[model samples]
Target: MLDFAIFAVTFVIILVGAVLYLYPCSRRASGIPGPNPADETDGNLQDIVNKGSLHEFLVGLHQEFGPVASFWFGGRPVVSLGSVETLRQHINPNRTTDSFETMLKSLLGYQSGMGGGAIETMMRKRMYESAIDTSLKKNFPLILKLVEEVVAKWESFPEGQHTPLCAHMLGLAMKTVTQLVLGLRFHDDAKVLGFRKNHDAIWSEIGKGFLDGSLEKSSSRKSQYETALSDMEAQLLSVVQEMRTQQESGTFIDSLLQSNLTERQIMEDSMVFTLAGCVITANLCIWAVHFLSTSELVQEKLYQELDQVLGSDPITLEKIPQLRYCQQVLSETVRTAKLTPLAARLQEVEGKVDQHVIPKETLVIYAMGVILQDANTWKAPYRFDPDRFEEEAAQKSFSLLGFSGKQACPELRFAYTVASILLAALVPRLRLRRLEGQVMEVKSALVATPKDDAWVRVVRRS
Candidate 1:
């Protein structure tokens, strides 16, 4: 017993010593924002979109602390810009690659190997971009068929049955994104069962880590995240093999897999693309419906537009141009819902954004949600107004919605088309109603999702 105590004490001391010695970077006061005693009113902001509420808090700070307000969270220095013009000028074409990739590395368990240079990096990113272009043009119709199957099956559930609308939306989005990107399906009875096992382990571990930042300290997180990556990769690899066997021209994965890309790079790019696409697209759909339910005016207007454009006809790809109002409603939802409240960049050394000096390695977060609320760029910014997207001018210049021009999300181009087509096709066939007493909330992970299931009734429309 005495010897055991001695060993235990020594082990803890040594462990503490080692963690301090090996990962000294963790000790810094990285001002990554979250809940703090100093920031209480931000609870509403945090509630609206969790994680990094500091960006909103910064709005208050900028009011109180001036144009350049620097604050601390998680030992990081976070800087927020008050001016969009200044931000756009300083913003790079590529997102400033950050240490979050370290978490990806642990999750995916890929060796830290580097082979490709500028051409290779550009090729990989552009190819990923280009393949999305191809999938949007090629694979989405197949996804629409699957969604149609899901929705057609869905309409039979009775008027008040209250099916899991959130899950179904999420599922269709996931299936669409994965199949479109990889050109494979995971709906196989056995493969789906195993894929669920793998996907759950991956999501749960990362979820806990995001809330607690325990992944940085726990070997178990490192292992679980990695194992999930490996399993996902294995699944993707098999799909890639099938794609090749089918003599498919090339897919996003097939494109990267064929090139001189490392497994880590392929897995990283694929995972990010698929995960981001699935999440943002689905949540945006859910949020859009939520908005429509709350704003009957918006819903009726959109339905009117649908009625005028493609009356009682299925939303063919050709008619997307005609469904302009529906696109505006979705756009306003992105702005009001603020699905991605903040976009971040890491700067190690002090840098100048025009005149202001942001000290080095600062985590500069664009308060995207707050920015959307600015009266200058937006009219009646707080209200859920979709009309902003109605005119020829608004439609043409609606580039601020993340996927505009160069900064536009590659997935955005495809997501709305699929979502709108689904909406136009199904809304005409079904009547949707919000289930009584179901309050919608937001949870911010990689992207924001409904806090609880968005329970709804899908009755077949006459």
Candidate 2:
């Protein structure tokens, strides 16, 4: 009888401990409104997967919980700010660290040179910004030449034939970014294509793998991702070596080589910029042209503006800002397409948004998609209208969202220039038309892309 009682007591104790381990007290202690963890281990992760993406999940979350909401991402508590006002409270212009860089480093698993004193960080930032500025200034004519080649190819297409807009744009972007940022070695078609293949493999995995923990789960995927990453690193290494040997100067890589950054730092930053610059520039141009295809009036207005500004000359760096209407078209496309849906910042210290106090080290999500589409802020938020930005308030709202002025990331600023050049070149000579029965479904990842190939036919404008 004594042995039976002891065994029973031990069993009961173990059961109680297991229960507590699996399901601890709810971590929803911030007094902020959100759903509690669906599972103790993978909080809201399944929800994110089911909703198709983090951005889509945020849309539903903000709809239910208002502008500011909290959700558990695995074991971590993440607070999402979905309104322009909430974003304003969350953004600090003077902060030493860039949240985009932080998020990107975490995604790519690149850690070198991420930690430093404030002066070092600022110096690195300035170096990078200057490199991009210098690259653009020095290579503007080359960029224009690339744009003209693409336009000429499109012009060669027979009338009424549909073009694969996404594929063409991706190719153009890859060529433009690689040659300009890495070096002229990418001018070779085979080298450019090979780099792109590796890039696509690594990027595709990085987008989906980190979200669902699948990269760690699948042995095949893990092996392939590693192989692709190694190949990409090797490619970058070769470029760095060649540049060092040649004593190259005045280009993007040349600028980085001259800087005090370590070889690893140079590689990592180059990878970040190349991946970001290619994907963003491609998608922005694709979406801008796609949107224009669907709206004749908008396209005509843009053409009129381009005609009035440039007359018969190719676009130059000096004349870019003078095309105000063209800028508006690009701005509207970004807002309407929600190019980058989500961004995040780790709360370095405890922060406050409205009545809630965000705990230190919490992940704060800037739900940019939600903010861009908020009907309260944007009139006809779903419509593809460029004139909405004619108001000073709308432009101010955009600047606050980090899409304009100095708030724009270096990659985005570069993308804007590249895209503007493309639009300027193409719009004056060709009329973009959407193919019948084609619909663009958004696949929201690090960048928003069409789920299927977006096709359009172009008619020569007399």
Candidate 3:
């Protein structure tokens, strides 16, 4: 009886796989166009892998199949929605849940074990928004302090020397986010170093996880992932305990502690914020600085803006909005760099968006990088021209997807503020020069990172 039960389960699994392979439910239901097979077992797997980057492969699919396309990733269905009209149809109406979040949850096994009702969603939003509000006021001083610290280190380098921008920026971003999330400085914290090591290991693994689910399948990586998660959880619980004794603090964990959330929920959200906050913001800063360094005209404008509006004074929350040019530079950097190349949503119910039928449970992806670079949406979409953003018309051309308007991600909004303050603190005091003839290329990681990390020369302005 036991042998028969095992045989039956295995047979059922094989049967389902065969059925999915034949029908390709995701595309069959929607009438979307994509690769004919859409499954990895097909002979095209090597060809798709040969494209080098998933972003490039998706772009090719969009070009061949038009707006909505479907394909499989290791048996899971993923549909790419590239056009603005198609994106608005799926994302604008379905605002409550995110596809990327669901994907992460699925990978982490969170959905099977954790609570995720409407109340949980509301609590999560409240925590994120509250953290943004607190960080804007409190994290500004910290951003400037970190900026000055970076400058001091740069000055120590002999004239004409260059440094790896990604490494340094990643460190600065980790410190800034660690302070905001944990309510303490991480630069000297030995435990924080351990946390950072585990985080880097896990993140590097995740970048490879996109190709195949080896991060989950491999024993070594799985053990490492679990250990990192355990360490983070233990540390976050400790932070929660310590926050209980403090009278006041603006740390995200402290704010969540004051809320009605259970300790587990708070820890879960803290880990999300910590991981997401560090890499995305670091890439944002690195790319923005890289673009500015390359564009002498833009750098002069930025210097002029900083000199006129701030001129050696401290950057405060009150003064942030007044730095309009800095905001435009950041916006342009995000567009040209395509920092966040994708946004995703899961259609829980059958939905129609602009004549496109989206099947229920479809993992609809917004190919943001493709959309932002669509020639119809902008003049010279590939060019790094911040002045183009001065026009209200240009700003309205591409919705930042999950960064602004009603469907904004609060953490990204907070990132904009943090990055703006970093620029404000540094631009007036330093002249950034891109190393001559070094071409910066992009790769899809947890977020987009330089294919080769950016290197730059920083000289203090006299």
Candidate 4:
């Protein structure tokens, strides 16, 4: 009886020890400060959802835990850095790998060339940058023409007519991006509209499906998403086949064809640029106009700058730089809107930020939304003040966040030029006013957009 009692005691002790080891209640492996896992399996995922969005959750996390914080994403441990000083330490200027590319490719399930060696990656990066640069230079005239078309359409609207701002901006973005990146086939309105429809289907699914694993649960949604993706890919493939037989027009596709990239490579890169470019450009313009409509002083100041600088002369590539205040307004718009709210980097090797060591292969998030709104960094961080960007320090800080200057991604650079032209063309001839009693709620996703149709009324500036 004594032997049996001792054996039973040992068994219970072993079982409890194993259970504790497998399902840790307070696992802080990195010694970083953050909430413990809410469940053994889901980790802090429910916490993320309850907070509304990853950006919002990060804001709260950083607010509570300071600049460097940690959280469990599923079974994986993740670290978030929410300040300029921490970000400066983490971002390596000499690193060739594009963190955004990695995230997008994972979301897209595009595997080719992703695991390439450093030299190959650098080569592809160069090719892509070169192609975008050539396309922008050659297509500058087309960009101006497209902006003029949008301005003309708005101008023709009768006084006090309510304009569907999001729709118009999205359409313009679709047309501009497609024609420049794909080919002249996009000049056909039907083709552009069809492409836009497919794009919307795929993009909406990609945003939602990856977020909550809904794509895996709903077969019909999954089927529709797959179909849309396939259709878009087919359209791109057809364009590639046609471009192969045609003369080079210095378009983005043309530049890629001139290079030694495989057909699949071209298609993948094209899809990335087309999707990212259109969304970023459209949202940037939409928010800029929305903000300008609310502030008469900003609109008037921008118009005065345009009037003084161009004075009836159309804006050219050389003239873009002279519009410094216009750039400031756009910069401020990006900052206030928190346009691209989140960015992430995988720690390829062990890394340290402010005494916390992030283990190799850990997911590191740049909580840009929090940093953008950090009161310590900006004066009255919530205010939409463009003049804040006039300070050299502000510009430096913005650049460090990858919104401007050489640090900005290629898509952002393209958006800036496209937006600058559109604003220059429209702000001078039209006064944008918000429709009364309309509430615009921001929906934060891969890109931030108005939750409903953003409506505005336009008056011809005399």
Q: Pick the candidate with the highest lDDT.
A: 4
Cα RMSD for candidates in order: 8.6, 10.2, 7.5, 10.9
Task: Give lDDT tens digits, candidate 3, residues 138-195.
Answer: 6667777877887788878887798888877777777888888887545575755667
Model 3 global lDDT (CA atoms, 0 to 1):
0.69
Residues 73-95, candidate 1, lDDT per residue (tens digit)? 33333466554554664544334
Against the true structure, candidate 1 reaches a TM-score of: 0.77
Clashing pairs in 3: none
Give the count of colliding residue pairs in each prediction. Answer: 18, 0, 0, 0
State the TM-score for model 4. 0.91
Candidate 4 regions exceeding 4 Å error are 1-28, 91-94, 210-213
Ranking by TM-score: 4, 2, 3, 1
Which stretches of candidate 2 lie above 4 Å from their native place?
Answer: 1-28, 91-94, 210-220, 247-249
Model 2, span 1-462: residue lDDT tens: 011001111121122222223223334456678999888887776787678667888899999999999987666677889999988787343366666665566556676766677788888888888888888898898899888989999999999888988888888888888888887777898988888778767766655564446779999999888998898988887777788878655568878888888778888878877877887888899999999999999989988998899999889999999999989999999999888776666666667898888776566778898999999899999999999999999999999888999988888889899999999999989999998888888766556777777899999997
TM-scores across all candidates?
Answer: 0.77, 0.91, 0.87, 0.91
lDDT of 3 at 164: 84
Alpha-carbon runs more than 4 Å astray in model 1: 1-63, 66-68, 73-76, 89-118, 210-224, 241-246, 249-251, 255-264, 311-313, 347-351, 359-361, 391-398
lDDT, candidate 2, equals 0.79
